[model samples]
Target chain A: MQLSARNQIRGKIKTITLGSIMAEVQVELPDGQQIVSAITRNSVETLQLHENDPVIVIIKSTEVMLGKQA
Target chain B: MQLSARNQIRGKIKTITLGSIMAEVQVELPDGQQIVSAITRNSVETLQLHENDPVIVIIKSTEVMLGKQA
Candidate 1:
């Protein structure tokens, strides 16, 4: 799917492998970039992600917001 | 200051420059890395970040969780 915003963070599914109770997910970005993140093994089986699947990476500005909330 | 987590994401305040209504936050990382993110100009002024200020980057596994949320 084409993104409306250029810098909007998103990921392309590369592969998923089981690792004990955790799943190692490899997500690719535009220009062949990739990052590996771990998640629940169940989530991986549930999602059933395959090679070349489009996925969104959602991040709230506040989440990245550094500072004490008062 | 020291980080307990080896890969804990954080930023070192490099500089903040005003740009229109936005503030360009230049954050540096270890090994001489950096990423520029834009925030409200007021936030910069409010935070009063100076050189070498430590800032945390919080990201939930669910947020980077690829696939649709159910």
Candidate 2:
């Protein structure tokens, strides 16, 4: 599927921690870079996400901040 | 600075498109994955972002969605 946000990285599910209303999903890339995403528990159940499952994390925000090293 | 968001990808600024109030910045990773971020012009100026500058794209949202291939 085509996403407008443009940042698409292939990662495997490393772990999933569920809370009452939200769930945290950790995705690990081939380079060992891990990206953690906090989403709704409903979405987690809807996506059927589990450990080692391949996923594409979709991030779209109007406030993508930039940082520089000092 | 420490951010609560977990998705921090190292990328270089590819391009910057300025609008009246918002700016669209394209960041390219080493693997050629391009991430497009729409932020405020004020932030773009505050961050002093420019083309070819190293940056960390910070994405924080309560709505990080997931997708799968059919």
Candidate 3:
């Protein structure tokens, strides 16, 4: 499927922390970098995400902040 | 500074498309993956973001979707 989102990172599920309504997912890239995402618990179940599963992290935000070092 | 956002990718600015209120910034990673971000024009000026600038992309979203191939 085509998405308007421009950032697409391929990573493996490293951990999953479930809450009452939200779930925190940690995705580890091949280069040893980890990306954490907070998603709805229902979407987590719908996606059937689990540890060691290969998945793509799709992020679309209206506020992508830029930071530079001084 | 510390941020609550989980995903942070280091990349260089490749392109910038500015509008009256919002702006589109394209960041290219080392692995050749491009991540696009939409930010307000005020932020663009505040951060002094421009092409070829090295910056970190910070994304915080409540809806980070996961997609798996069948």
Q: What DockQ does each candidate score versus the true complex, computed on alpha carbons?
A: 0.23, 0.64, 0.66
Ranking by DockQ: 3, 2, 1
Query: What proportion of the true contacts does each candidate reproduce?
Result: 0.29, 0.70, 0.76
Candidate 3 stretches greater than 4 Å from native? B61-63
Q: Tens digits of per-residue lDDT for model 3 on B1-70?
A: 8887777778899998999999989888776767788888888888888899999978774546677776
TM-score of every candidate relative to the true structure: 0.44, 0.87, 0.87
Question: How big a share of the true inter-chain contacts is recovered in candidate 3?
Answer: 0.76
Off by over 4 Å in 1: A1-8, A62-70, B1-63, B68-70
* lDDT per residue (tens digit) for residues A1-70 in model 1: 6432212345677787787798767776554545455678887778876677777654434333444223
> Could you give the interface RMSD of each candidate, to one decimal?
7.3, 2.0, 2.0
Q: Could you report the Cα RMSD, in angstroms, for every candidate shown? A: 7.8, 1.9, 1.8
Query: Candidate 3: DockQ?
Result: 0.66
Q: Rank the candidates by TM-score, best first.
A: 2, 3, 1
What range of 10 consecutive residues in model 2 chain A has the weakest lDDT sum? A61-70
- Of candidate 2 chain B, the 10-residue stretch with the lowest lDDT total is B61-70
